[model samples]
Target chain A: MFESADLTILAGLLSRYLVVLQAQQALLNSCTHFYQLEPRLARWLLMTADRAYSADLYLPLILSVQQRTYNTADLYILRSLQVAGCSVHWQAANDKRKFF
Target chain B: MIKENFFEQNHLLREFPQDVQQRLFPLLELISLPLGKVLYESGDPSNFVYFPTDAIVSLLYVMESGASAQISMVGNDGVVGVSLFMGGESTTSRAVVQCAGSAYRLNGQRLKDEFNRHGMLLFLMLRYTQSLITQMAQTAVCNRHHSIDQQLCRWLLLSNDRMPGNDLHITQELIANMLGVRREGVTDAAGRLQRDGVIEYSRGKISILNRPQLEVLCCECYAVVRTETERLLPWVFQKGCTVKTTEASMSAAKAD
Candidate 1:
């Protein structure tokens, strides 16, 4: 096995392999799980989040979600953030609509 | 068959008690929304609440570099220009017509007047606003994690839901602009979808050939948006309407 390289080289190679494998596995898992659900609904969730203003910025929680492939738990947390954010919007809508 | 029709289509407004509907309905005026129209540019003072009847509007935020990505889409199912009524008096986002149709426009003063009344209408709009924010937040997540193809599928579905036609009249360039990606990415995604028989594109139009397959290829972001939108604003299903049957029907169709 190529595992017998100098210690530093071996560590670098292993880390690289791990990253590649992680990426591949993430894609495969997302594909499999999403394939199980209705396409429009699944697709909607992805695009919906992309449309957020802070989408370009990283949120600590969202970062944790991104560390893994798309998962139900990640989606749940995303929904919670959406709810909280929306509550703010809800307040604003009510506030703005209050003008006489 | 006037702007009131547009107001009635807004789930939040429709769910309001009759008294609330009466007060708000009188303030709404029918407005023609043409394709490519900008309701207001980013940072402009907000002045109206628009409820689209058939139109699809996109909320886009631009950077100093002039790059922009859509923050959300509003259709008959929702309202636009919440910032006007939300007390912000202005928004950093731009509202543009994603699909050409019509909308019911409520004057800002009148809308605020109604909001001040503080009843079901206020509660409904606020809840709906929460749903919108949820959409914005989730869009950020999806863009970071999902592929362009999955994002395209979700975009198409949302547009299709709002549009009266099956074919979407939009260019890849516009899509790239909305996704904040290069045009080449959209081209590649479109090519893949065409090859997969999931959609057909000619020039600026894209027609769905297999919605079910497209859904399978999409990520979980679509579901999150729908679920959040549903939970934050339960009225999306319509009064007395059951979503379970719709869900079953869709599943059965997909199975077939």
Candidate 2:
């Protein structure tokens, strides 16, 4: 349903995004000992927001998908973000509420 | 000295200039790499660099808590022990044989000497290193963003590309270790894949039943690594194409 030109442009943009994402990941991996969790979390949140095109994001789903458990530091980081004008909500797994 | 034909089995060695091949062939020691063989442990000084002809090696970064994840994989299309030529005698990653096969090993010093010549070997090694970096970076991103099922598909596709057959002689436990996930997670994912008719797993062996479906199910990480690798090392794939064409023409002539 799409024209060739449109597909080409989309492919180009996707490739550019991948390249930048790769560079960012490589940097984070190489400097794991140098950077603290706060900056890393902030960067991740900002990138997620940009990609999702919304400030309202779901962290629990991401945590479950990555098979990661939140520690005190992670909870503290979320609280700090909430204090910085970002609304934070905790929803149970069975909750049917949709906040878009 | 091993037979000269053995060199052709490895794409990187196959593309060596005739003179370079003649010089290097005498130095290569062919050895069988068994599954779970530790080529080099993390932080250990590497003594030899291996050019795998039919083996798959996983470069894993081990954490302090004893967990590890594969950063990249090296097979016939490339060489192991980049740190040897990259001027680092040791790396934080451990290289282990993921599949049982043979590889031609060269003394680390000998490879370093050859690399310093700034010839075809140097050029190829640099390009291969770039591709390896791309793979490692893509793996980091995949680990962060992709689901376990998608990651398993990506892993299978990448491993399938480096070997000869549709069957992979690896266990779910080893795959779990490589992905840094629980064994149960891999079991569930592999089960789903089998149910979908994409693969068949039986007693540590996995046979890919439908490659097209597997690719469709894989994440973009696999394609990103494959594209970058082919772009950085075009000669590796080109050599394969040339051989296929030569065989086809020879068969046609024989038929006449």
Candidate 3:
């Protein structure tokens, strides 16, 4: 019974590599479009994203994903370190899970 | 001369802290994943984990009657063997290469050793595992509730996003096998997509002419999977991964 969603998990991670990248580009394009069509809505989204605590890390990755020529090796190294820090944070979260 | 740094495009290797990645580079075996090649069949103990650079692999759930349906698709963004890490030691599904391209295969023992460290590599993999769980859950919902046309669209979008080009080299029979539907159903759904000008299908090659329309016509399953994947594992969110940088650092490993 461990078929526990095998294909979904693989595709989940795999397809998102494109989805997130393309979606970020698409969202940017839509934002630019919205800025022209509906400035308030565009501003709201920008503000909302800014409030997210981890947006600092995510926003640059999204921006870099958009840039056609930016070197990613450096970004990959930094992101790995940042993510590793989160895992120790994950261990803390796992410990907290015992409470519930 | 054997090429260098080809694995840099692979996200798993790229995401590894440089030193950890450097340690694994020499052991990597870059090989061609030809179309229709089975990476592993049910119950096979995984000997290697493949990081697809430009290929696509479909995991299919086979029935006792020999019928099967694709459970998931793995592209350059993912590795072929997850069971190796999940403590399963084996998988019951069949992994077949859908696209003809290349991948870097690392010995399973090496992956196990790295994973055991519980450091950055293990951390990243655990996060990846979360996204996979979301995807698996969504697939079940989509399979049960969505239309055949919608399924075809999702499957096409998945396969299309995996490889480098716009067109996919696939046949209706193969699509049927993956979707666990009849050949006639795939032909019919594909015909509708072609007629709507969303895709151009000719001689087993599908070229996506309009992705927006396909997305619009697709069910919510695709969107749900995409959003959750980004939310759970944002590290893989990047483009132009194949672009080469710092070949000097990469090539230094060759002498070792």
CAPRI accuracy category, model 2: incorrect
**lDDT scores in order:** 0.65, 0.73, 0.65
**Candidate 2 lDDT, B1-256, residue by residue in tens:** 5656657777888877777788878888777788999999977998999988777999887766677788788877888887766566776788999977778888888877776665777677767777888888788778766889999999999888776667889999999888878999999999999999999999989999999999999999999998998899886656652222133433443343
Interface RMSD of each: 17.5, 9.6, 15.5
Q: Cα miss at A36, model 1 (Å)?
A: 34
- Candidate 3: the clashing residue pairs are A9-B132
Residue-level error in angstroms, candidate 3, position A74: 49
User: DockQ of every model listed?
Assistant: 0.02, 0.06, 0.02
Error of 1 at B234 (Å): 3.0
Better of 1 and 2 by DockQ: 2
On residues B57-87, what C-alpha lDDT tens digit does candidate 1 reach at each position? 9988765557677778898777887766655
Screening candidate 2 with a backbone cut-off below 3 angstroms (N, C-alpha, C), the clashing residue pairs are none
Please give the distance, in angstroms, between residue A27's alpha carbon in candidate 3 and its true position after superposition: 36
RMSD of 3: 18.2
Q: Which candidate gets the maximum lDDT versus the true structure?
A: 2
Off by over 4 Å in 1: A1-100, B1-7, B238-256
lDDT by residue (B80-153, candidate 3, tens digit) is 77766545566767889877667778888787677665568766776666565555555545665578899888
Q: Give the TM-score of candidate 2.
A: 0.71
Least accurate 10 contiguous residues by lDDT in model 2 chain B = B241-250
